[model samples]
Target: MSDVNLATIDLNLLNVVATVLAERSATKAAVKLYVTQSAVSNAMKRAREVFGDPLVVRESYGLTPTTRGAELLPALRAWLEEARRLVAKAPVFDPRTSTRTFTVACSDAVAIALLQPVLRLLKKWAPSTRLRLLTLDRLIAGDGLARGEVDLLIGIPPVMPPGLEAELVYRDPLECIVRRDHPQVRSKLTLSLYASLPHVDLALFGDIDDTIDRALARHGKAREVAVALPHFSSIPLAVLETDCVATISSRIARAFAARMPLKVLEPPLALEPIEIRQVWHRRSETDAAVGFLRSLVREAAG
Candidate 1:
């Protein structure tokens, strides 16, 4: 293959490629680009001829990207966005008057603990901006951010993929949760008592068992998990109905106790604190709208 210089390539074709990838259909791309369907089809032919790849192929629903298309989408989109931003006039994001949407991906625990405060602040400060909270499957957090599917992700960091930017919002200690009326609540929970109690475990992305098990091993003990769930929100109800103790974030544990009959105890054994962070893609680092939303999240978390 000849070494072709991308500098000599026509940039307009990049825009067409990005549109096709986003719309996934020549008809849809034509509608979006306000051009004829034939024009869109011609653009696709030119793209294939230039790149020597059938970028997209018809699939059951619409279009599926080929390997080359998949590899080019991110860089092409980022390049086009950067080019546009360099030449386009910047619009001031007046949140109070602008009707904009911010999508956040986070676990239910952070959503329950911080969303209300964030919404309250938005109502007072950016009344017209709307918020969408998505419960992210923990494994997909990095992928979601990288693909621009979610505007922000709030959770423990070091879990996020490389190249994403994260800020420490708050540090919350781990605490033990049990029924307020449980027999164990009346006495100090020794390491033996803690391990002996039936446990309700929360397995976010199927890794909770490994985390807690490692912690237990440090004390030469292991928890007898009677129940395991995917969300922290369900632990309160599970504890209320059964003789089970749950290890959870102090923020979430206290939030649960305010509404439910639950007891919060300091874990008898020393465990590492969980640091909650707000993570976003580097593409949004300088976006005015995303900047406002990030500030709002930081304030709410405080």
Candidate 2:
């Protein structure tokens, strides 16, 4: 059922109704529109009659929009924004002046490899923008993207969720990292030696869908996991003090080895490389801010 009475309604009152509901006061809406308060009050009366409801009500401090009024907000805002954009000259996204918050999801390994460098670029170029980095949890990430809770996702996903798009940005091979002083790994790390050594399994994330385990199982061999912990940053320190070797992406291993006493060796088993990607929802494909953030990520990865 609809309450639209076409004969007596003035279409322009819709703007007045939106403005009144937004400002929560007829006087404020009139001031914003540079019109008299009485004019706005009359317009509001006609708008209420047209809609057959009191769209806004007087509370103690201010007026509040009713449920029907609240429901109209998004479409009304979009319509008003489109109207403004139509009259504006040369609309473009200026990141330097935009105070936007961008969200990114990735594995701890990817964060260890790329987060700092990407933050450096963002701080230098888009000073006012903020970045929120969350660890990748595939189970809920797809829902987050759909609900606009997540902005961009980086790293390998077992499968791309529907309504999402991705671009492969880089690849890193799996490698075994060990302390330089490890007694048994003097020359060529052999499969028998690797299986014999204690292993540090990355267990920071809840799900344990590991490629290393799958690769090992394929060859009918299993490595003993001496310890399991979260965070790739701590893996180096963990391996430094123990006889355990950690299997991780080569880039993360290189980054850690460059700063610490760690050695990167190709994993004895033929484990597939990790493919890093930047993923976003299809609905955000044409958004300028999202485009800018994606470019920044691609540049940092490159």
Off by over 4 Å in 1: 1-86, 138-142
Worst 10 residues of 2 by lDDT: 204-213
User: Which pairs of residues clash in candidate 1, taking residues 3 or more apart in a chain or in different chains?
Assistant: none
The sequence of per-residue lDDT tens digits that candidate 2 reaches over residues 50-138 is: 77788888999888999988887677788888888898875577989989899888877888888888999998889999998876665
* TM-scores, one per candidate: 0.70, 0.70
- Best candidate according to lDDT: 1
TM accuracy, model 2: 0.70
Instruction: Flag clash pairs in model 2.
Output: 204-230
**Cα lDDT over the full model 1:** 0.86
Worst 10 residues of 1 by lDDT: 135-144
Please give the lDDT score at residue 129 for candidate 1.
84
> What does candidate 1's lDDT look like per residue over 1-302, in tens digits?
78988887766888888899988998898898899989888888989989899999998899888999999999998998899899998788898897988989888999988989999999998898889888777327447788887889898755656779988889899898899899766646788888889999888766555677787899899888898888888889999999899988899999998999888999998888898888999998878888999899999988
